[model samples]
Target: MPAEERGKGPIVTSTYRVQLTPEFGFGELSELTGYLRRLGVGGLYLSPTLQAVAGSQHGYDVTDHSRVRAEFGGVDGLRKLAGQGFRIVADIVPNHMTVPVPESGNAQLWSVLRLGPESPYAAWFDLTFPVALPVLGENPEFTVDGDVLRYWDHEFPLRPGTSALPLDELLEAQHYRLVPWTEPPGYRRFFDVSSLIGIRVEDNEVFEATHRVTLDLIDEGVIDGLRVDHPDGLADPRGYLRRLRAFTDVPVWVEKIVIGHERLPADWPCEGTTGYEALNAITRLFVDPAGADKLIQTFTQRTGVSADYGAVRYEAKKHVLSLFFKGEVDRLESALGEPGLHDAVVEMLAAMPVYRAYVNPGEPPSAEAVRIVETAAAEAGRRTDPGAVARVAHQVLYGPAEAVTRFQQTCGPVMAKGVEDTALYRWFPLACLNEVGGEPDHFAVTPEEFHAFCAVMTPTTMTTLSTHDTKRSEDVRARLAVLSELPDVWADAVESWSGQVRFDPALDYLAWQSLMAAWPIDVDRFTNYLLKAAREAKTSISWIKPDPVYEAGLRDFCRKAVEVCGFSVASFTAVVDRYARVNSLGQKVVQLLMPGIPDIYQGNETTDFSLVDPDNRRPVDYAFRRALLDNPDDDTWDGQKLQTVTACLRVRTRFSADEPYFPIEAGRNAIAFARGDKAVAVATRLPAALERRGGFGGDTVMLPPGRWRCLLTGAEHTGRVPLAHLLSRFPVAVLEGS
Candidate 1:
């Protein structure tokens, strides 16, 4: 709580991620400190706390930056959490603010809407005069009451002296217009969600205004660090980060998603990304790439979807750009000051490998950015007009400021909606690889490659397995990873299950995958997740385009899947259960002990079979977890997982963040790493394959020439120890060297 400790990152090695909602506010969090402390937590990583819309769950739709949300007990609650002696990393959203329906929650947005471009707050938003609000449905009606315009539970401010104007005249007289939801406007937005309008953090006054309270909190030492939300959405990511670092002296990290071999931009002044890149490396290390052919064949033949990741991504990108990104496309085309380049631009965007190019106008693109653009352009040229593509690409890379910024901003959203959301849901050969910024077709990462990734990582960068945004939990992915080693048996089970409970053929394979991975789930949970999956795929249904008949059939099929195929799914799970256990404990220990302050999502220490967002956000039964951690030697998966995670956390706390990683090559089926010289982690990968090879065949790990004690089992050994004995009790062994 001293200002002297502010800039120094968390004093401990690990932080626990908690999704704070109205139900589990600061008071509730204060209650969990005892448990977190027992679990070796050094800091508390929180969800967004700024005042968002009423009853908002995730809190990213921030409405007020000057005040914390009252639903979560506000400024006082935040102060209390900080007082609990946990270094606080407050998640702040400076990129965008919510455009709530009532329009009064955000006073800045309201003032801008009421006063047009003349308002003092106009510079805070990325809107123009006569802001076009795309909110109308068919048969739209509006009424004006004293100083207010009303539209079906939505209220807008009336301009001065326009309360008595005719309905159409009043609509035209206001500083904003209500158009059909189909007609999206040209204001900068967070991806395709028009309601969450982007803000101009490039402006100094706007940055100060939006970040005032948080900065003050940092000065007071109520917040020790910051996790920036979505920096790529900014006009100048470098300038924004530079300005951010200037304002506060604390560790800052961005929610940046880096693709394969694409490192974070070196110029950005931040620690590192929130660790999707590490997530990819950790999950893939458990996968068996040799099984990719069999899995892809099964998926393609059974579901009739393309196994070519590139083609699936291209089609998905093309579909999303046409459906939701027309505004962005039109904006880019206009900025380029060119004609007939829309197709060229869309094709290039679809082919883009990274999220966005950080090319400023008049400045040459960075080498990495150049490589990314060249790769995409080469692919785009094969499909579209090469001349047009070349023209648009040249303009975006080296032309006017508007053209460059517009192109850079458009790339992030298109990649997110197309690849991560749509294509991931559509192409599911191995669901474990279908994560954010993950390649489904590209299967495992060799231990050497994983070490290469860890070698370059900033030590303070956060590392995680399951996060609030991951497609599946660590446990779910662990279960799914087992299928790669048993693809033949999996294919036969799916083929048999397909003959019984028939849903949409496109979704049948995915449903089976999810059901088995997130087993022991209820019918409601299973069906709800499948519905979301169906919508994300955008094949049979979508969030905006619902097919009730199809949904009903899907639900009916879910019931049948439980009634008839449940036994088979259970049988299939039973066969793969031990391997899943190996993966569950292996990945958990690796994440906890690996480089970069390891972070654990709430309830992940034991077992979490959750799917995406709402499911992931479900409350942690901490009392149960506390009891389990109290007696972690009960010979169950939860007990073993908790022990392994706890052991790694305790060992990790002893080491400083600056400690280097030394990879210890164990064998073909194991990954071993020594952090500095005192701690070493060894985890089993592809346990089914290891079993096929008959238990390591005398594989051994050379310890760092000292008597080492296993943190999990308390077994001590010297020199080279056979993994068969070192990891006899569990799939993972955490050793502390003398």
Candidate 2:
């Protein structure tokens, strides 16, 4: 496809990552396509469609790369859905594959095991010790001539005649031996995720096979683009991407997490990342940095630790390194071909700069930073040999800074040390903060940031808000904006309710924090989602151990608090009325205004009240969304949100038909740009507090002489009316020349 074709119109996309079961059918996808078309979405960006292990919800664990998953209705269904005119972008996993064992079926398990390095598939995987890698940390009593690997299959049985054992007793054996690779069978492999054996995609044969599957799909017109998952995991990302691009015309986007201003290699054939950095920029712009600082200090004081940001940062880095690099060090040592060079390389890289040096205008980190890392490595070398130290350092430094930043942010609450530490710290805060970088503060896409983003965000790039992995649904985040302005209201309610209920103040704080963070609003169908999440979290003592007996008491407390604080059921109803008005208007504005192709995850146009991961991945309600799409005049809030989104999309498409190029000038909380003077899209992203503070004052916007009307409210204001009144509704003005 031509590059301009991808960017010629507004993009509306959605993510589908849940397991494909018989319950979800071709009819559902057909209905979904029509709904999306009505919502003005340009395409459907699906998660991996390749067959995955049984019951895998997020289909990243591919077990068969060549076949479409039957549960999702296979190729015919996909083609039928694609015929609806929605572009299809498939998420592909090229870095690794799920290793199948005897229980999974084929008898090639034993053949591959006994053949060792002689097996035809030996070069397909990145195996460590081909000769003796133990499958389950066991030393088999008998050594076979060929490579031997073991699997923990509870189904295999020993013959009674040979072993004098009952079938059930034999089946109880913990490990079954067989080899998948010929290398030393006893040594462990990298990625530490044994079930997901890594592939050497840099190998010509392996690369060809992986590319063939994707190429075939593109050839069949079932897929328009590709999203590469975990690019950093590959040995040569640039090489892999280049080769993949060579075979197909489809646009490719790598899932790179940007930190600071680091850029992807300009030479690579892919466009840009999944936009974690953009998400971060949006959140940070809105979040009060001073509030963040206060929370950090208060957390430290309460914990009574002599800790700075760096210390917490280091600890979080350590945790991620442990998970991702536990076994990869030995592999690095062998590759470097020197006893101490691995450690040296690690120290040098860490000190060089956490970000890609080439992308930054500032010279890499100061020499002092390098010197400091060297010093630390030297000391570490003394305790654990230099080679070992370097190995550890390499793993730590190579991991993305975005991951490190996330770790640092989470460590604050983790260090607070609550019951069910696992539940409190695992994914909640990380998901909440994932969108922070996209906010205006940290990564404003200011004229400066915009220039940078524009330079990077090409046609192949994917822009989104609610993915399967996001902590909160997009609608949830949208509603939470209301709370950002009412922190005192939340704080006061929690305080009074905590006192009345006699719950631990700290625990009460955390509970309220989660509630505020979750932010269930009446407008976007999120209140029910919030209630569901609360109930789900309550099931596991891990998230909150609010005395079991007090579960009802706590819920009642919440009910009363929300009511007494004027956020009661009746108040919530009132808020819903306002939300209906705002959400419809806002959805239309976003659908019409954003420059990049907009992505709408399944069911989001009507109401998306999901939480992160599994919650977001729940089977989309195509029936409901289809009903809304079919009924253009359904007098409901969700229907309104959909209608507005559709209207904006139509407007955007019409405006960009002839002349699409334009320049954007920055204003306080607003972006002003002219679309050939046929229309001007002035998007207001005012902070809730600023909006409540009577809005910003200034005639910072200088427009060409003309009469203008706010596209949203249709309130005409000519010749530079007060920018404040013009911005009251967070207007996205599409001014037409009179």
Candidate 3:
């Protein structure tokens, strides 16, 4: 294919969690290959496929770099599937590898652990002490050795005898039984996660070993591209990426988290980041900041917490520092050679002009930022070692600022207001909270803005709507947009039921209920599981265990609330019915019409209302997808919806054959674009709450003279019709000019 042909239409791709065998079977790759081609997807963007710890659902904790995972049909299956014409984009983790314990039976990892810092593989891992030391959390009496650590196989320990001694005791042990370190006295590791020992991939040898398998796949034409995970964790990402680029001409994209105004390194040879910024921008555009503020105030008043947003933000920072930073600080202290060097580093970091917590590259500071650190040092009542204080301060300021900001944005309201009578708070931060400070106006990409972004994109760049990490599924977000228009109705419903339920962490509990109604999940056993999760999160914040009395009351309240809200036992059933039709249609619209390559997450072309992480990585029902694709005319609603989306996908593939490019025109609450004289696409983002405006061209972009006919509804209009009327039946239109 010509280079221009590759860049022409939106590239449709799907993300498959390698661990979810049911979602994308290694054995069924042949079947999946045919389906992907039929669906017109140009590529498959798979999650990490390297051998991971057993039962590892998301596959980030890779155990080996050389081989494909047996759970995902291994090397043979992958190559066979790649032969089917869909480009393969493999996700690779270079920063770290899973620490192998005894039970894993991996002699190589065990050898590294046993040999400690002196082993040939020592350079592959980042460790602080020359001797392997046990990591301590809350419990302080346990110990972990090479043999013992390897013995412990489960996620959470069950019995002391079943694994190594407890973690604390391992730290206190005088002599180590595990791997001994080769480094002098002090060494450093990444973040405090011992199990996830960082690698020195910047080393030429380490880089070759890590890239060998991937490069071989590329050579065989089995893998078409790469997504480098955690680029920030590496010491020299720019150099590492450039080196990788030297090996292959395949497209490479870095998974870099964009914190505020941070731009990608100009030297890195990659297309673009996986679209988190785009997601953040699009989501913030519709969230009601005033409403969020009101919720915060209401919660604060109810809880008697005097801390404002900034204060709460500080507290969250302190919490993370206490939990995850001490080890990193110790490592940095050792590296600097000076006594109290950690504090000095922190002081300099706090005083630095720019915040680059993870990767600091600059000169030693003047005294101004030091003065601020000194004040903090004095307040702690100890003669704060200036160096130590500075280091700690730097950790606080730079280390987890983005995560802290995200948590503050999401949980500020919950922390401010105590949960109703239960006096509990929401744990971590809920997704709803993060939507604040993300006002659409803050980063919304209008047509002009999108054009600016597009101007920067080479034909090799990737574009997407949903990914494995997105807070809400794209279809869910589209439906949630309806709420922006009908906030009053939702508010009224909440008000009516406010007095009936006695939920601990009241606001969060109520919020969960509302979320349940808004995005109805399976009401069978699945509903019970979700309800249990809600209760668990509530109790964690409340510092209380589940109570029978409260559980009964909650059940009763839910029943009454449903009754009052005119919902039936069939409410969830009704929701699923409508959601199936609407969301499926919405997916088809986005997949086909959106500019750039449209990437579909594993199973997202159907209904996937999964929450973040583990939830989103659940087993895919490939059988269902296969059956739906095979029987496009099935009578069932979900099957019908699937057929509809598939049909539209087929049309998009056919239309894209001619290689059409569209230029957009803005409307009051709508957007109009033309694809030559053959077709024009019009889309409305009408929030139900916004007043219905005079039509597409009132004060919006004036439409050019032409007779246009709506493709879906066949309505004809000379010049421009009232957008409100045009959009009453359809949120989007693709008009074929007569």
Candidate 4:
């Protein structure tokens, strides 16, 4: 087998991502392998399959890593898949584990609790010694009610053997100090999730202990490679990557989110990131940059809010610190021991562009990290105290390494909650541009920029359009991108709709627009999305203190909004579908044939118009997709999308890693590129613009001198053919050298 086929280089064939749960575990996956193979998928990229918090749908909150969860069909199922010749890329959460209750199945964590510092597993977790960890109420008040220790509404049940022990004695025996769930935990956690405690994986013993099962899988040939989840949360991301590389020669990709112009650390020994940047890039290519100003105007007119994402993000981050993470801020303030430092620290964290800087223990912080902090501090200093700003910046830039590490750890959750969770929903400048790690302010990615990014990272990057974590599905976002092209029509339609019904105008604008994109959308899905969106926005109702009145009002408004907007939804979907048909096929062809390795999210090959989590992670209809693949005559949009994806993947397998990439200039309405002599991809980026130009306006795409045939339709074309002729059969074209 070639190195690429062995998961050493780019995953030349595509990877299909599956969200595994008890509801849809290894048995279902095992059953789907032949279908996946038929669809040309090279590997199965699975969600965390380890034993987790009981009944958790997403497996990130792992309770134990020693073995697969029984609910997921365990070792037998894994071997079955491996026996069938499917490559497996497993997601590993090295940063944290589920904080197990005493009776839970996690032996290591339970052992630490029972044996204190003397436990062999004591070094596995990060804990503050001799301090009572806050696990319940603000005050250390607990009542032993039989086997359960109750604090307010919370309960920590003792194990069967420990039921006879007194509550104080039980508490004293634990290595960790449990306190009320507060911010800036005495012990580190995975963001604000108290139940998922951070581990000391940087410790060699801990690394060996936690990764034993996974390494065994790799050695046994059941697992081909690893996907590192949230390496930014670790104390040393670089060190961890080095350690991960040492254990296996199999390919590894980190779940790192690189912000605007932020490059991945060249030194980290991994394949590349899990492709949010690529997702953002491909999605934005289809958006019309010409409509940015008009959409901004329409957004402000309809919603009465500024398109200033930075300001909104800053305020939202501040809200997170004050409202949700008070304990964390308190911890930072205590660490600093200086007046007015908390405010400055929050400002600096809010301004951080990337997730966290990997500052080695002995070295000064990287120039990039220092620049980000100093710049944020300087900007904040103009409004606050210079002395305070300097002190905070100094502490971050030149302080003890652990303090910096703590702040870096704190930044991850703040960004995830405040930016991705809150501000993304609140700021609806253009919902297409609103994605995790996306900069809404950046607007669009030019061909030059997209190609440059590919040049640097394509060989190892995991290119994707949608994932389980995306805010919206690719097709939904594709429809929303239509609004950017037809701002006048969108604004007029929204204005007319707003006059018919009354709700939160900001949310109304958001809901109505999204509803149009996801039309043929049902009431239950719409209602669930609105509730989650409202809570995430934290405007009228929040997760902490939900306003029942406002929620009822929002719910009623959504039902009526759907009723009122039916005609508009029909009309918008008609127009948007035309554009989406082109965009969906375009993105599929481009992503699969682009420079990087492409990953197909389950069901996304069809029309996956899901909204967000729970919705996005729903079960895939393999029978439907399989039937579509089996019979290629149905020309529906879903069938067309699957056909386009399969065709591109087929052509992609012929590509060699040695091929030099050449960007083809195909005018403003399209983006085209070539791989050596044998393969080329051309996708329509702005169909609306093409309509305005009456089709391609004599724009010519340079081919490699001779005849090439479309891989999907077998339409042949010669050198410098008119754009219209090249894309006459399909909106996107993937051609092979004849």
After TM-score superposition, the amount by which residue 178's alpha carbon in candidate 4 deviates from its true location, in angstroms, is: 6.4
Give the per-residue lDDT digits (tens) of candidate 4, residues 1-738. Answer: 234655555553668899998888898888888888778887889898778877888899888778787888888888887788878999999999986554335677666665656779879887655434446545578777676555665555444466567667776543445665553456677876766778999999999988998999889988887789999888888889889778888888889998887878888887788889888988888888888998888888777777787888888877776767776666666667666687777776776666776556467778887787777778878767778878877876677676667777778888888898888888887897889899887778788777876677647668888988999999998888877788888888888888888789768878887788778877888889989999888877777667888989988888887887778778768977888888888888878877666899889889988888988887788888899998786789998888888877777677764467888888788889898887889999878777877888788898987789887777888788888888887888888898
Predict model 3's lDDT versus the native.
Answer: 0.49
TM-score of 3: 0.71
Ranking, TM-score, top scorer first: 1, 4, 3, 2
Give the Cα error of residue 112 in candidate 1, in Å.
Answer: 1.0
User: What TM-score, computed on C-alpha atoms, does each candidate reach?
Assistant: 0.98, 0.71, 0.71, 0.94
1-738 in candidate 1: lDDT tens per residue? 212256464444777888888888999999899888888887899999889888988999999998988999999989998899989888988789899978877899888888887889989877667888898999998887798888997889998888898898889899998888877665889988888999999999999999999999989989888889999999999899899878887888789998888888888887778888888999999999888899999999988997788888889999999988887888889989988998999999899988898998778788877877878889999998999988987888888899999889989999999998899999999998999989888799889998998889878788899889999999999999999999998999998998988878789999999999998888999999999999999998997789889999999999899889898888888888889999999888778777787889989988899998888999888888899988867789888888888888888888887688999989889999988877999999999999998998789999987788998888998889999999888888999987
Better of 3 and 4 by TM-score: 4
* Model 2, TM vs. native: 0.71
Per-candidate local distance difference test? 0.88, 0.49, 0.49, 0.79
Best by TM-score: 1
RMSD each, Å: 1.8, 8.2, 8.2, 2.9
Worst window of 10 by summed lDDT in candidate 3: 415-424
- Error (Å) of candidate 1 at residue 613 is 1.3
Clashes of each: 0, 45, 40, 11
Candidate that would win on lDDT:
1
After superposition, candidate 1 runs with Cα above 4 Å error: 1-12
